[model samples]
Target: MTYFVKYLPVTTGNSTRLYTDGRDYCADLYEDLRSAKKFVFLTGLHFMAEFGLIRTGKPSDAVATLAQVLRQTGERGVQVFLLVNQFWRDESEVITGGHPIRAKIMKAGELYGYLPETLKLFDSLKGLKNVHCRTDIHPNSDIFATHHQKTVVIDDRVAFLGGIDLTYLDGDRWDTSEHTARHRHVDRTQKFWHDVHLRLQGPAVEFVRDNFLQRWNHGSLHTIRKKSLNSYEAWSQHIGEDPRHVAVEATQDRRPPALPPFAQKSVLSYTYPADGEEPAAPTVQIVRSMPRKDNWHRQKPTWNTNRSDEWEHSCKEAYLIGIRSANKYIYLENQWVADEDIWAELAAAARRNKNNPDFRIILMVPYEGLFAAGLGSNQELFIGTEMEDVIKASRSPATFGMYALHQHDRRSNVQGQIYIHSKVLIIDDAWSLIGSANAGGISLEGVRSGRDEPDTELSAIIHDKAFASAFRSKVWSEHLGVPVGPTYDVHDADRFRGLANKPGGKLRFFPGYDNIKRGVPTWFPESLQESRDPLRIDFAKQSRIIPSLSRDLLASGLPPTLVRAAFTARVVPSVPPGWRCWYRWHCQLHYDPTEPSGRDPRRAPVYLKLRSLKYDRDEVWNYSDQDSVYIGKLSAERINAETTTAVLGVIRCRVKILPLDEGPNDPGPSMVLQFECMFLNDRFARGNHPDFVRR
Candidate 1:
């Protein structure tokens, strides 16, 4: 049985603007923030204080930064409300050690930075009489779960929502497909990032505004300072500050030039798309995974409660409905996907049309984890393998294919893989859902036991084909580096293949190495609407764990799966050799009618998991032998009259073989290699011919 429930739809007229990544999204959001004349309301997982939207390094310094603009707007008597999620996690545990109880106390004192890097931007705003900031933790919410809604509703007329978090992962996030790593400084914590965001207007945005106030009016602020920042006692009194009652009151001293309390907010009003930009005709609905328990109760509730709200899980329901109703195909981009119900639902959709043989599910996720689930991130690999196996074994009519996106400079060959961090879904190019919630258990589940409850999340549901079609084209254009105009039909399969087969594509697609025999249109990714993948993708040459310690495979009594103990010697001083990874990448693919799987010389990931060799014990580092290594047609030979494939073992790795043996106590010179594989979409098509498949 699948998770399905009818959700009462909150429908309204709306206008929307789609953004590819933080580059344009943040810039546009900055414009909206600076332009708002009345009030600014924002909620997010992380409102990073470290100047995210302001490009201080670039030439543009004309406009004020977001902080300065926010301050200036608030100073003009405009009400500003910021609700940030401040859940607990010993975030600084790596850097700062502490005693348990005392550490908790000290962490509370340093409240602004204690959360998961979410709410520092508004810390300085507490002083402003007009700008109100509060960090929220639901009385029933698991301490490990925080509010993960990324939204902004300005003047009650415009809204911004989606997967783009306001943080500086680095300048790499700001570049186009033709990326240059000139600003690449990996050590400084600025790694290139990629994400998607959206802008909204009309009645639909009204719900976005109301969501902020509902939480704001019910929300309680916890301030650390002793003195009140405002001259009048209204601000403190409103926050339930009883000066005479409790001597240990949580009071805050007023900020610079301390003005009297600002006027209160009443009836909210604003014009749609303020500048009179034409509003899109999309019918939109505001969907959310908001808790039913509003800030209604007066007293601060205890840590965790089980008071379920009216809105059980509207966001999750929305996803199930979309997947179940998808007729032609389902295109998705997400950060994490650990939902078994949704996977089953998609498989069911495939099974429904098995006789006719045509249902498509194109999913794009990070080739590796975005930091949460690494290549070796526990059960993800296991579950992923299971999902793939289920789709193949069932022989369902649905064609499920997944691919990772990458971009490389032609000259320097500095390949930058575009991380699919957007939590997005477009069903049959008719409906779209975008927001902060992941497809994983943490963000999708309504409730969970222990410390693994779902984070507070928000998403917008757009049912307009016009809006969804435009959004899909925008994504495809950015990826393929070719202009797919607004009128490109979403239902056209041959057109997508024709465009895909044509020469130039800025972005490169890498189907999972195991998908070689699936014989689907691997070249044309999910964004491009294509027909069912012909080949069912069946292959089995799997071996990801092989790093036997030379000293003794089991001499130290460590299990066979581990490649541990590089340096552990109390008396004799004997250091074990590090892991050496070896795996094959099947390239120059051709139809081998003679082979049982219809494919020979398969490519599989060479996985190596090593722990505490020189690093910390708690963390496991993942490395692939074929990472950044480019494998092409080294030379293909015909095996039979009807089949040909790349000669096995011809694509040898140039990277130094592991097992650094430079004496007993020395970690030898570090070896580095970059790899890239030419992913084949069709085995028998003219595109896979030697003349078309280039270096």
Candidate 2:
């Protein structure tokens, strides 16, 4: 499989450097900031100006902070913009339906606040004409969703995007890749901080620049009582004023900032231009998950005809495409894996390669203790149990493995698992994706049931073989306590699995089942689960085209007969009877994982049973011959595929056939429909599929 996908755009002449952990990223970021000649734009979910960037060689005053660096840079006439997520309001100020704890904390002592360092930073930066600091709220108005993207663009020449945040509280995010534990105090102690950040040096930096300027200049439309939310004001003002005294919400309108002279071109224009060929240089593309609203930015749309106000879920589309394209192996590491859609795709891939002895699906996440610290829900246990059932029912139960990282201090008999905060996905040692989004519904498929907005996210799809393979080896070597060489080649899946089970390595099987018996604690209340790690999603399975299928056909001005002739001729060869497949129309579709059968015609799940196919010669369609056609018998009793009628018209538009490795000679279809993420449950979704269903 190739690293680049034809539908997605790719930018050439870009250089990339990877940081496996936060310590190295901070060092490089500090030096880069010190060398800045033009301007700097930085944003993150949590931005702490007090975060140390360098060791000053004194025990009492041991390091220089990010605030110091920003001060020094501003003194040199460098324009600086800092945009950070704003979730907490001062005790005296509050917005409508904002921050659940605000009312309670105010009633207690009238001194409620979070992240005092942010306020300190704002006060310190006062009167610095070259530096600007602002707090941004997610446009969706969903109190739970946040602006979670961590991106930095330096001088419009280099950019960094990944999961590493610029704050440290109970856990220091500045820990080395080794995950060493050197002290017991919160300030001095270093917990394992495993993350991935990419530094890009080339024209691709414009994408990062565009994203920042859009968020930075978006005027605040939210209101507190009658007053508009402040975006260009001091944080300390909120602390001084009383929420009860504020009257008539005043409007705060902001104009879009001027773009750099060199950034007049759009990133979409840099796509592969030559037909039937690609550029000789490595490439990169930026993808984002912006909400349906907030289209006030000055940047152009990704598509020429599409409006900027339309919802953009490019990050989700990238993940689904990457997972389905893997041939040899798929490696995933993230803080959480609660997204059922992602799990469904992974299970389908495992089923396809169950009989291939060399195929492997490896995953790494935080160990039990650390996992529980973030949230109370054991989502991994629930999803992991279903996945095990899927693989166990298959012939190759060992094809899928889940492990976590652990480090032991023999001297003090203190041992704990290294927190796996990185969000990364690598496929076949050829392509990779790294960014701030976790493998969960909140990060990927945003805006659950009652929520109004999705968490804003940014990720880059990279197709450079050298960078992908070398970074994969570096991460694997750290987990297995061995170097990547003859014994541990990048393509050697068997060796990687063998080393994961051996002692002395940091990797250990995630004890999901055991944690069930002992019980995982819910540090937060049950009501907050949806807010912390949202699980509800209502996305359509086949809705990710560059342009809507119906619009494309209509805009072409082609007659119905010619349109059907063009698409119907693109079908794959027939598989055996009883093989599961997806039967979908070209219209808009919706699937709700929570309630699949509840009377909504649009939300009804669709699946089919392959009956037979009569080929017309080969790969060609002669409409005159009725016998030369493909047919799918609707016989699934569980999903009521035969009885449940959809309100929308259904045409025999497309069918994705999954060829179970029934015998040693059978190779699967070249292209797959990949609409199975909308399956209702385990029985119909995984076990009832072609490979694992009992005959």
Candidate 3:
């Protein structure tokens, strides 16, 4: 299998360096596009026309940056195409419950008025004839599975890619000074956010350009010229190749790097575009994936069979190639760090001889979970537990370490806390991939997100020694807790010495008891088994009395509907499936090495019984308790005494109730009673139970 890679060069000695703040980058990009003579193709997840250039101010009066770009290029007879994720306006209506009935009616009227206004904006770009703008929607999933890849390719000679979007949010800056709420809300406060982006000029530009063309032409909606076509002009001129573009000599073709215990591929050389009108750069390959069909607007579907496999292959190949070839160290930054397989490989590499220690891997991730809020009950806990498992599985406890950097406030002398937004990997000193692809299956396989196409992403390989050396140095400085300056060197002993000298600066190990300077503690000083087990709880006893208590509340003049809804929703303190599994596993694994008896057999059944009960209960309690409450509240105030009695009778028939079962010896009954009481109390508090409220 052929793996694609490219080299990007950073312009040295220029303060015009790229920074993470979106506004600065956007301004620079806009200038670049305005000056372009050749082809211009741009793609991003979302691009609302409302937000414009500039930070902390009314959007620049540049009413038609995009439209102007099209017209100018068209007037120049240049081929200009723009591709955006086909966001279904109606889908939002369905997801958000039709966006408030009032808003829907108002929006319909506005659309009628806005259509003519939008047409006027379209007419302003009359000079540019060869322009086409369209939206590409993926079929596999909803609007959330968007074409997130952001790139701007001009004449296949220069390209830009990173988390920077074309929308308004992309232009905000970090602000450290305290400002009044009104001032901050009015966009006067200099609130900056951390982010990263790359400009590619070498062979990589071709890959990005190709990706944009493919997405634009394959989109569901195709824009046509309002008038007859005049002469067409090419967008860009082929300036000669940059002198720095080196020829890659073929080495003995090694087996494509494999998941470790197998040899890995090393980075040989990288090609990047040189800054300036200095000749064009070497060839860079660009690879992208998205849903096969454009579901953004209603259109015919485009199918690609190998897209999933190809997307997964890209990330795996990149890692394998980089890891095998890495001789010194690897640096990575991502929004999340939870990939078990890759962590395993790093652990293996770290376990090698202490002298060589394979390669040092450094990762920077966000301080808090990105999608933790959306996860159902216990999902966040499961993810956290799994991440720890990955860390422990590593060969050496110290093999991996994570950190977050806060951008400093120049005025307050207080550094803004670091928020990692860039997903980057730099292996050895030779290979680097910077793009929007997170370390997850959805980004890799395009499967879970209902995406028919792979994630729209862009990354370029960098080969320049100076660029790699500088970039790697910056990352290392952050990892080693060194100030960013010329004093640090990865190969120098002083670098390690400086780290050792800092207060509480000793190297920390994974799964081992140690104190860290920043971030939460991962390992405990003593065995974790001795501490209380949060998962341990009885389900059977809880199940028994819960139904009885719920029925009692209903019989006592509580709305039956409310009681039923609360019971079905299961929100009133009950063992969720994951909690049960965890509890069981903890008991089974909670072995005391000090005990003379080998692993306890009694502890083994704990997990088994838990699993069985969960499976069975799932059948009994699958309905929504919330729904029940909603319905019961609307019913007659008088309690349906007969129905309540029937509910209690059914509970008694289904569950074996015993007084002793309420104690520690029988955890199930106790849990059932606790759930039952809480359910009734909640109903009474809500005035859903007339008897309790009246009494």
The number of the candidate with the highest lDDT is: 2
- Local accuracy of candidate 3 as per-residue lDDT tens digits, 196-238: 6777665445456545544454444423222222233111111
Candidate 2 clashing pairs, residues 3+ apart or interchain: 226-248, 226-249, 227-249, 227-250
> Which ten contiguous residues of candidate 2 have the minimum total lDDT?
539-548
lDDT of model 2 at residue 148?
Answer: 79
Which stretches of model 3 miss by more than 4 angstroms?
1-24, 50-79, 87-89, 98-130, 169-192, 222-284, 290-312, 338-340, 352-359, 372-386, 393-397, 405-418, 449-453, 475-695
Whole-structure CA lDDT of model 1: 0.47
lDDT of each residue in 580-628, candidate 2, tens digit only: 3333333223333244432333556443322223332222221122211
Worst 10 residues of 1 by lDDT: 565-574
Q: What is the descending lDDT order?
A: 2, 1, 3
Model 3 lowest lDDT segment of ten? 372-381
Q: Mind giving the per-residue lDDT tens digits that candidate 1 earns over 1-695?
A: 22122233334556688877765776787787777788888887555554446454675643444566677678777777776665432223211322221222223223323342333455556568888766666544322345778889888778998876664422234443444454332222223455777898876676666566555555433433233335343342332442221111232222312212333332223222222222245556666665545433422122112245433356777688778777676777787765666777767767664553445666667644432221112222223333554365334313655545555445555554556778888876677888887776557653333222356677877777887788777776665556777654443322333343232443322233233225434342342234222121111111121111222322444321211212111110111224343222222232334542323334343232223333333122223333222211111112222333221111222222335433322332222222211222223212222211210
TM-scores of the models, in the given order? 0.60, 0.63, 0.51
Query: TM-score ranking from best to worst?
Result: 2, 1, 3
